[model samples]
Target: MPQDTIPNPILRGFNPDPSIVRVGDDYYIATSTFEWFPGVQIHQSRDLVNWRLLTRPLTRPSQLNMLGAPDGCGVWAPCLTHANDRFWLIYTDVKRYGRTTVGGASGASLRDFHNYLVTADAIEGPWSDPVHLNSSGFDPSLFHDDDGRKWLLNQLWDHRPGRNRFAGIVAQQYDPAAQALVGERRNIFPGTALGLTEAPHLYKRDGWYHLITAEGGTGFGHAVTMARSRTLEGPYEPHPDGPVLTARDRPHAALQRAGHADLVETPDGRTWMAYLCGRPLPNRGRCVLGRETAIQPMAWGEDGWLRTRDGSGDPELAPPSPGLQPAPWPAGLEWEDFDGLDLPIDFQWLRSPFPDELFSLVARPGWLRLFGRESIGSTFRQALVARRQQAFCYSARTVMDFAPAHFQQAAGLVCYYGASKFHYLFVSRDDEHGRHLRVMSALPDSPQADAFTAPIPLPDDGLVHLRVEVDYERLRFAFSLDGEAWTWLPEMFDASILSDEATAPGAPAFTGAFVGMACQDTSGTGLPADFDGFGYVERAYAAKVG
Candidate 1:
């Protein structure tokens, strides 16, 4: 075998907790969205190298809500599988936190796990309405055995005597036709072994059932552990040397945390694994972009043991096979062409219930026109479009022309996580003057009601161009009277808080699953704002290397 040459974090930024499945030559992956709306992003890859967001499976209001902005709530880890010529997805919807109590009763903490099964004739679906699994756990995964027996795997709170406080992996027989578990659920492996195991995925290979899990917590100490059982019901034993993949032994190990891995074999019978990890910047332990997705080559030892190429017993930055060749940017999904009928898959709205009526995709033979909605701060349910955080260092620019009857109508480009954490440059009609540019950050818990810099004057002419340059650590904002002379704005934001640990407490940590870049507008009154001509480009580090 050739030396495993790993790609540089194939999916960078906020893409976390990846679950991948291969069907024919096509590969599909899904990730967790803690609070962001349009939960459980679905991505497709051809050679497992380059990826593009295909669609968001869960978009119905009945399926999700952003009220009180359910911190760390919404879609958890999702598993995608194809069996018997049908595609199935098993996922968990975290309803509410167990923190609030009524009267003298104490509430459950992160309890109430609701699992749903959605099946489709095609990978890209008109998926069936969710068949509520009604399971008592989260991070649900599905596996089908050779004999056609289906098994459902999940992580739930351990309720055994003396083990009430811990979480563990549970497995039960599943009936896809019935959309429910057939037999009694049994505890397979408790977090007690590794102290905090979750995200359990089972694979049958060479007549042995392999149960792989994430442990040591989802922080910097995160790792991937493997166990094997000769029979489905096990006296399973942990590998002699635990944690098949980890960053602890790497030279740049300080910057990585390998966890929540999904293993798959390519069309040519080559084994590969995709997992999430983060690259830490100076002074900031994690960037707001959160966890990113990476691939590595895996091989089975003579004894059927799984290991990486180096045999260093740890996952490396590069895999053995030549990485996926980059393909030309997919059409109808490029961020550069902003004048389209609908927002591209790369763009995502903030943590608000997306109202379809408030937005549209009108081709009209030319240019994308975004008709915005009411005020940004007026309601948590307003339409505020955004995309995932793609590159650590990149520039996003957009040209806009909007007419606001009142000064409250604001439209611009923003890097959004939830309502609380976002920075944007907007052009609003000034009360005394004409249009002006204002830069602001919406800190969720800040005492400062309005954390905005002084507004800068803009030309009365409707046309305005804005640019934001992110240097991984600091983001610099600049705007121009024309596209030529760019003037740097005084407002610079520290975007280190976008890490999985900092932003999402119980969420898995990895890098680069963000929806990637968005454009939006808000109104103080019941009015609409129009935007046009948005463009973005990833800054080449070599351009700044000198």
Candidate 2:
């Protein structure tokens, strides 16, 4: 507790389900990226408080393919560790999302999940391709024992009609020599009795094996629980003091749904826990930014139990910093001139590979050329490149040099939350109106799907400037032929349409909100749109106390 301040969320915006590890004085953490390319996001930190985005593993299309992935189905949980002097990563790919009667009973649904592994000689890869593992369940982690033995720990899914969807925690012996998990998979623990047990991680300390799990279904009920045993595999005893950490019962807490924790011991003999938490909108309780990564300091008691700094089982906004100095990185990018050969690290695409043929910087120097593909909301091929919306109040702008010759071709700025909900400001050529500019607010499966503004006739110069100003409550659109003179649209639509609570009753909204450029060539003739520049600015918004 020497340093003055400690930023709680080491990594911000959509970085959830953190797993941390230490190699000498350096530390590394990885998080999940569902349906987004560059499957696993890795970050490096010298001090536990300040972190930097290092690199993303699962870069190749062969390693990750989200072609037909649904809203929240792709990569699940990623567990990163340092074993055998190399960095090892284990993650799950959730393919299908539907009801199933696997084993639990009838009317029980389970996702089709698969586990895989990849390793690198150093923290920054050259990472190896994935090695297929069993699909027993999701959130697979690798635990190395003292005697050079490897084991894989994950959740066992139970589809019985009346049983818990998350059955229990299981571990199987993995042979490094054979590069496969051999021997029988043993059910070590039946969860902490809190139910919905998942995201299990094992560690050995003080001659005892410690296990951690996330329970209570990832919403306001989410939490972190712990158990320990004398042996690696046995009847583990749950912590007598209830959940080691959680915010589910504390409705007025600053950080909500704090769970899915992973611990790391620094070289200076300090312990910290990196977990997932979210800040929801006041009154509505909508988490538009998705789950983010937060850290809490820990201390060991005389009873050999690990607890938070205050032992209240709640997270802190600014915990005491460790020994190292703060070396924070930029939260997100604000502008892009399209002068570089590659997209910035902050940019990402929806459920598709980073198409070299679709988006290009070489095609038009100092500009980004995006070749149109399928329609905007298609789960398959779509021409879109976006970045996560890190804040609720922000302004996004883009200048386009595109003249759609037909109604089937359109290009413009987009606010895409998932497969079902989005808003678009586009320019297209209509049979009756020639080329026109319009705004469409879409929230499919919800009540806001039919909202569209009247089209305005556009000039034929092929140069246009579009802007979308976002506040906490609504979004306003505007356009201009000259950069200085602007014309505001007539409609002010509700911003809550791009939220987690606005989706359909049974749909999943795991990912956060995004804004960027998207185009489509529904006519089967590929058309390209050139964007001269793009800018996004996040303004300071006051937080409402719960």
lDDT, residue 532, candidate 2: 89
What TM-score does model 1 achieve against the real structure? 0.86
Error of 1 at 410 (Å): 2.8
Model 1: residues with Cα > 4 Å off, grouped in runs: 1-4, 59-69, 97-108, 158-166, 248-251, 322-335, 351-354, 363-380, 405-408, 429-434, 443-450, 459-461, 501-524, 542-546
Off by over 4 Å in 2: 1-3, 98-106, 330-333, 448-450, 542-546
- When superposed on Cα atoms, how far off is each prediction in RMSD? 4.1, 3.0
Pick by lDDT: which candidate is best? Answer: 2
- Candidate 2 residue lDDT tens string, 1-546: 336767767677788899999888778899989988768888888777778778888888778888888878889889998877898899999887643345544566767889998889988888888888889899899999998899999999875567677889999998877779999999998986678999999988899999999998788788899999998887899988888888887987888879999999877677889999887877567777778899978988889888987898988778877767656666656778989998777777766765785688889999989898888878788888888777778888999999788999999998878766778899998888889999877765555555678889998656899888776656787888877688888787666667666777567777777889988999888899999889988886632211
lDDT of 1 at 158: 41
Count: clashes, candidate 2: 6
lDDT of 1 by residue, 22-139 (tens): 8877888888776666778888877666677787877776666554445456678889889999988888877664343333233334355688888788866767778787657778
